[model samples]
Target chain A: MDAATPQLRVKRLRAVLQSVRPFSSPKIELEQYHTAADLAARILLLAQSHGDVAGRTVVDLGCGTAMLAIAARACGAGVVIGVDTDADALADAASNLRALEMEDGVDLVHSEVGSFCRSVAKRPRPAGVHTVITNPPFGTRTAGADVAFLEAAAALQPQVIYSLHKTSTRAFLLGRAEEMGYHAEAVAEMAFPLPKAYAFHRKSEGSVAVDLLRLTREPPAAATAAAAAAAGE
Target chain B: MRLVTQNLLTCQVKACMDTAATPDGGFLSYPLKVVPDAGGLKQVASPFDEGVAKSILPRLDWAALRKTAAELGVAALPEEVPAGAESDAGFLRSVYALVFDIHLEEGNLLCPHCGRAYPVRKGVPNMLLRDDEM
Candidate 1:
């Protein structure tokens, strides 16, 4: 495979990502949406270019079917942990990993995103998660569910987080990010195609404008102080 | 799941979520006991990468990994990571194999403090807590 060009690399990555199995029976309440391979590939490629994916420990909160998790591994992330509340989604994720010969690169954990983050926070040692990439529920069913996912990702203390959110909520999430001590910006805009997976949908297909929001953790107080001292010298 | 992932997991029970440690000790929730069913433990060799191993070394809880490795009877690890272990090729290979190559296909991760069992099936651990437990 002559993936000398970035375009070729993305093409190859997308080809593999297309095989990731999506939700068998997506639940409306959980907002289990299948992330298109193209979008996932683009997001992961962007993260990789930013030095956030390769050799970095990544956590995919709300990892339905492990789309982003698998992509992160494909991008050379050292360790990828996919946490989902739904066991069936995780089953599909496992199968996807096996079919792609990527089973060893990622681990699936059956837990709600918030619960998993809480556990990581309580551990005596840091979980060493460096990046988090998630396409969370868009908050149509449950109010604040999207923010809840963001909160969980932040709790993991990752260096950077790439999350998908409705572009409409950009202002609110950016504010929340600031409150949480993260410097956030929308890095990419993409349309998330929604195939009719639920009964409530009026149309057979729809698309929502989403932003690939990147949240970088600000330097800790101690690190900032040390940097300031060094600069003074 | 891989032992590398296990090294990061902890009991998610509500009680366990609020505190860093049990009153008795600071390490109760983590390094969950790995109890593999008959023929559940397996290994698939992966290419060793010294850079990746060294990068992950700082994130690992050496004590927890040693305890978990000991419990599973997989490999022996020193009480402490030796000096310059990061640069030592032999040390990196063993650690990489132990953490990344081993897999728990079917088992239970029992929380030492709460006795709550998180079942591992088909290489994925179900860490979800029941509503009441949550």
Candidate 2:
């Protein structure tokens, strides 16, 4: 396929992803909000441009119904792993994968982010994971949930991670990424639509400013030191 | 689950690597032997993308793939990735079959380390551990 072929495929896949239904969990504490398909496609395209994806192993943390996971596969990911704690969401994801004929490329694992990361870390892959794209809970319902996801994704040591978070917390998240030995930058910001799903929601439909972060692990101290020594620093 | 997926899995349960449990413990479980069910094996045609395969070659555990292929009675894969394997059309086709075409629809992935079994049903591997195992 030509260079533009994957881009066109991703466009079609994004439409299919938009058709997948969001989780209907009654508890807001679950933070089971679905990522808008257009936003996911944009993040994926950006990741592709940076050579963080395309034919690389991609992991989707807290993958609800496998929207990002499916998108990654459609864009030619070598392998896509979707980790989720909710069985119902995984079931839905499985159905969606079948519908899209993407069951072959994607694996939906029913597990929390932490355990999934640990399991993947134990795996013996020389190149390790290529990218992790996740839209974790915004931490509105549960405190520190987004951080937990970030911590887990960092633990996997992917080449890069593309994560979505509320724009207000961009500074704090970047600081945390720095502490974890990752160079993070907000690559894009957009209005994230939040449909009313709970009694506490004041508006039927509201949009919140959200940022897409691209995080890459910092060079090891030894490598940096060697480079500096070569330069006679 | 496809062999490509299995190629990336390792037994992560703590007890599975407990030195007290086995002699050669502490090492991650690899090449989890597949015990195929009566109708476990299936074949599906996948788009042959040489570029994707080339990109994945560096990341793949070549030794593990060789071992798994041996166990599965696939003799096409060589012990070592051939020189210029990336551009070799025949070798790339073989690699594609080993990675993408074959599927284990129903089976148990028996960890060589702790002898723990992870069941595969409807092509999904249940990697979740019990409470005590965690």
Roughly what TM-score does model 1 have, to 2 decimal places? 0.92
lDDT of 2 by residue, B2-49 (tens): 777788677757766443233443344776888889979888888888
lDDT tens digits, residues A155-182, model 2? Answer: 8898888899999999999999998779
> What lDDT does candidate 2 reach at residue A75?
67
Candidate 1: lDDT over CA atoms? 0.85
Runs of candidate 1 with Cα error greater than 4 angstroms are A1-3, A219-233, B17-25
DockQ comparisons of all candidates to the true complex: 0.76, 0.44
* Model number with the top TM-score: 1
lDDT of 1 by residue, A1-233 (tens): 23356667778888999888779989888999999988898888878767788888989888899899999998888888998988888888888888988888888988888888878777876778889999999998999999999998888888888899999999999999888779888777889999888788899999999998889876323342233222121
Q: Which stretches of candidate 2 lie over 4 Å from their true place?
A: A1-13, A24-27, A124-127, A218-233, B18-28
What's model 2's lDDT at A155? Answer: 83
Clashing pairs in 1: none
TM-score per model (chain B)? 0.93, 0.89
